[model samples]
Target: MQTELSKRLGVEYAVFGFTPFPAVAAAISRAGGLGVLGAVRYTAPDDLARDLDWIEAHADGRPYGLDVVMPAKKVEGATEADVEAMIPEGHRRFVTETLARYGVPELAPGEAAGWRITGWMEQVARSQLDVALDHPIRLLANALGSPPADVIARAHERGVLVAALAGSARHARKHQEAGIDIVVAQGYEAGGHTGDIASMVLTPEVVEAVDPLPVLAAGGIGSGPQVAAAFSLGAQGVWLGSVWLTTTEADLHSPALTRKLLAAGSGDTVRSRALTGKPARQLRTEWTEAWDDADGPGTLPMPLQGLLVAEAVSRIQKYEVDPLLGTPVGQIVGRMNSERSVQAVFDDLTRGFERAVDRVNRIAGRSAR
Candidate 1:
């Protein structure tokens, strides 16, 4: 169905798939849904440009989008210098000691020299935006907050729609003020960075708060009933993240994690700031447990925390270690065990929506009768 969102993005359905892999972005767009490439992992301009080029080539000319983390508030300018300055000597020492405790080796000569905490937020994001604008991306989305006004203006000038993610109605209003074309009302159940509110309650609150602006429901939505509930609550579409992690096309999925996700319950995930310096929902693992322990060193803010753990996470993945590392995931992971194609996932959502609509109509008909 061509809802306002679909019309805005010139897509066939309102389903938006968010992922870091370019292949996933291309696949979702090919499947008649808007796929958004998460650009946070691209550490350099050339890296982002390459990924965008790959996505464009594989997208088959179908519309897609790009998402960047542009936090509304930061440590004022939050440059690499500022981040380095703010990182307490004790915190850096703690990071080094923690890695040593885990038997993770120190970086080689000239290896640690390139790792600057604020590179993504300040430099890389700008580079990504420049590359994305040159491409045919239909939408530009900000993950943490409303994008900078200049960024929004630049997108608009290039005839692209701008969207921002929000955890509350208050945040929605802020996005609206910043001239964001869409608001993704994410709840506590969302993977990665998220707020404390539940989706069922937050969706309607955001929809009501940002009347004319479209709201997309996010968090804990993996089934047809969930999509129907969001639509009924005035959402124009649904944004899905964790559900796709277990998909066959996901570049990051491993057999061990796939099995773990299938067996996980809704309560298996926890919101911890251990990874990103912001409360993000991810599968509970020894890594997360270690950070939450009072005896353990507390996490650093945003980029610093991310920088500290990047090497450890890479090592864990390189070693295929399950107990030590897990990626960001939501409560929806429990229902995401099966390995399905992107097209198959879209088909399931369509069928679910139809069944849910039919069930509602039947109930209404019975009440009338």
Candidate 2:
């Protein structure tokens, strides 16, 4: 699993683990890989700082990173309330009707929504970046695209490498031009927000498009064999997200959702705009179906769609609405059949990677090392 990127980041493997939980992030770093904490979940600066403090204390002197979701250009003067105003009355009616039809209960009296929608805002994301740069983070990545060139320069000034997620060769070239140190080729099969290209076609194209810039292959990767394949495609590393959701360290907060993920096959996931307004792959549920319905109000874009669904998402998870309850996940869900510790998953990946390498060696008329 060793590669130039791994060695440069002081990790034993060229695996970059992206997860929302601090425990999982620290565990990945401790397991000889770079753990990147997704920053979009942290809307408050103090909360992000607090979690970074925890990761630093528990990371065993290993390196970790932060992944923030912000648009390439700054979005100005767009408050949450302003975004909320843009949601049509029909969209609101649709959400209300869907929840009522599903028999999903509303939040209990005085119960907070349990989630906030400010993380995607430029102001909030900038606060996150401020806290992250103050920490000992080794890498700073943008989940949406390349942050402004000034942001990249800021990361470089602090001696932290900047990376961005790109779905196409053109996007990779853009990131490279923006001075991004690395580019993660996140394909259509990936969870959360992603693009239309599959990993097989996207990875090599990105690697070649940004030659001399390190590339991490993402999407539909969960095992050592997949890691080997990533390297064979000229990737300096592999970036993974969905494979971590079922880890014992993960806190998905809903047992029913976990069961749904475990039971899913590669064919079970669909790329829909239900989760984040963008085309993101997730479990196909009645929720997605409603939005995808021809007669229903179509989904909104970016912050608008996110704001529209925030309360409904909260209710769905709070009450565990079976048909409407689902989270972002990738096609790799088929292999995540049971809960396992982060360490155990890493062991499987390394062992599988070794076997894959040996198989390849034999195929080339050589013995296993």
The top-ranked prediction according to lDDT is: 2
- Which pairs of residues have clashing backbones in candidate 2? none
Relative to the true structure, candidate 1 has a C-alpha RMSD (angstroms) of 2.7
**Over 4 Å off, model 2:** 73-76
Candidate 1 lDDT by residue in tens digits, 79-113 = 55566566677766766666566766445656543
In the order shown, the candidates' Cα RMSDs to the true structure are: 2.7, 1.1
Per-residue lDDT of 108-165 in model 2, one digit per residue for the tens?
8998777777888888998999999999999999988788878888899998999999
Q: Name the top TM-score candidate.
A: 2
Model 1 score (lDDT):
0.82
Per-residue lDDT, model 2, residue 302, is: 79
lDDT, residue 364, candidate 2: 96
lDDT score, candidate 1, position 202: 98
TM-score of each: 0.92, 0.98
Candidate 1 deviant stretches above 4 angstroms = 76-82, 92-119, 366-369
